[model samples]
Structures are given as structure tokens and as C-alpha cells.
Target: MSVENVMTLEKKKGFTLIELMIVLAIIAILAVVLIPKSQIFKNNSKNAGVTTNVNTVRGYLETKVTNNGGADSYLNAATLKTAIASNFSLDSSTFVPTGSSSSEQLVNPFDKTKASVAVADKSSGATNNTVDTVETSASDGADGEVVIYVCKDGYVVFGVDKGGDLTQTFKVK
Candidate 1:
């Protein structure tokens, strides 16, 4: 071959700018598609973590109460709070809102200003937590009826809210 023709063939052997640009564009598109799905997967993981923590708290309470000889019925908010407080051995400092006057333990992660409890009572049932509307302890008036051992918005509830039908859907005690 001629010297000039050989030089031209060598020049064409490497990738052109257009080819490089196309490859970069494909990679960018794939990254865009995958990023959001990865975020969603991360959220699902957080939800599962919350569920596990809340259940751990519940199981502890159930075991304590069952072994204690059916000590007392949760009559009103105060009595229930005291009973739960003693049974679970939860410290009042864990209460959310940043002070002794807060009353409730944890705020919902979705809405950090609002209260959410791991164990609640349904006063006729409403929302997905039909078991019991979150209530303040009538006794202490500085603590929520539920101990809220895990992150807020944790604990999955199941079934209808009835006189005594509130129960955790999963194995959260």
C-alpha cells in the first residue's frame, strides 16, 4: 500500500468523537433510570428496619406481662402508662419533643412534629393504626400511652379495630 493510504487507515482505527459521545450518553441514561429505583429500595429497607425494632420492643413487653401473673388491666391512660412503664422498664428520657413535658415518646419520621407509638389503643379505631388512637397518659400526663421503643412510623398494624381486636399484623409481640 502507499504510505499516505496506510496513514489514513491507521487514523480511522481509533474511535471517533461521535462514538465516544454515544457511549457516554448511553451510560448517562442507564444511571438516570437506575438511581430512583435504588432510592426506593433503600426506603423499603428502612421500613423493614423500623418494623423489626418496634417488634422487638413489643415482644419484650408481652413476655414481661405474661409472666407477671395478669397483674392489672389497662384501665385508663394513666394506669396503662404506669403499668406499661413498669412492665417494660422504659426510661422517661426517651420521650420525644425534647423535654420532660413532651409526654409522647417518638414522632413520626414522615412528620417529625407528630406523635406515633409502637403500642397504641384504638378508641373506636381510625387511620391505619385502628387499634387505638394515640393518647396521652392520664396518670403522668407527661408520657404517651405507648412506650415507642423503635423509630417512629415503625410497626405494621393489621385487621379491623374492634373492642379488643387491635393486634400487630407481624410478629411484633
Candidate 2:
């Protein structure tokens, strides 16, 4: 090959400072967008987990209340957790809803507070939605620190619609 042709054919070496800066800028931009989005998705999963946990607990409550004959029965926070530990497939130590201390306080997926929520039929709707209150731990009450309650005919957490199933949606009142 001719010397001039050889020189012309020499491979380009190293990136221009501008090119490197552009690539770095792109990565930075992607990080900015993706970081928040990832967090949002994580929170969404946690929220959906809240709904699923509430529903599962409600079903167990139904069985417990019914086996005792009638929906007049109820379960308090500690007892309810114990029941869940025994009945559900999770290890007892980790059975409580996640994202908080497992002692007794149920974690709120939406609020990220130690206050846990519960569900049950208050109307004994007899094949309908039982009014359940999403009970929270202390830090949300005048007295400070309360337990979750599920009764035969009253509010449990929030006023759940008597609809057959909850769509896993919520807006803080």
C-alpha cells in the first residue's frame, strides 16, 4: 500500500471530548428519568401488595367467623396476626404485612406507616362486603396506638363498597 493511503487508512483513535460529554449526558438523563420511575413502580407494587394482603386476611376472617357460626365474631390485631401466622403459608416471623416492624403493627403499603390495615364483613352481608376499617397503629390517634378491629356490622378500615371484589384502588381521604 502507498504511504499516503496507509496514513489515510489509519484508524480513528479516542473519542472527541464533545462525544464523550454527549454520552455522559445521555446516561445522566436516563438515570434521572429511570430512578424515579423505578421508585414509583416499587411503590405501586407495595400498594398492590396491600390490597392483596387485605383481601387474603379478609377471607381468612370470614372462615374463622363463619366456623364459629355467624359473622358476629371478630378478631383483634394481635390475635389476627397470630391466626394469619398459623394459617397462611408464610413463616410466622415474617407473616405480618411487610415494610414495617413485624411485632404487631401492620405496615401500610400506601402510607408506609407502621399502622396495618384489616378487612372483614361487618354487615354479615351474608355473601357480601363486610365493612372493614383499615386500622392503623399509634401515631394516628388522639390516644396514640390503637389496634385493628373487625366487627359484624360497622366500619373496619375504610368503607369498602359492597362490590364483589375491590379493584385495588385508593385515594387518601
Choose the strongest candidate by TM-score. Answer: 2
Which candidate has the highest lDDT of all? Answer: 2
Q: lDDT (0-100) at residue 95 of candidate 1?
A: 27
Give candidate 1's root-mean-square deviation (CA, Å). Answer: 10.0
Worst 10 residues of 1 by lDDT: 155-164
Local distance difference test, each candidate: 0.40, 0.45
TM-score between model 2 and native: 0.52
Give the runs in model 1 whose Cα sits over 4 Å from its true position: 1-6, 9-14, 71-173
Give per-candidate clash totals: 7, 13
Q: Which stretches of candidate 2 lie over 4 Å from their true place?
A: 73-82, 85-148, 152-173
Candidate 2 lDDT tens digits, 1-173: 89888787675678879999999999999999899899778755764655555555555556666676554444544566566555543334443344334434334454433334432223343544334343333222211111224444422432121122233322111
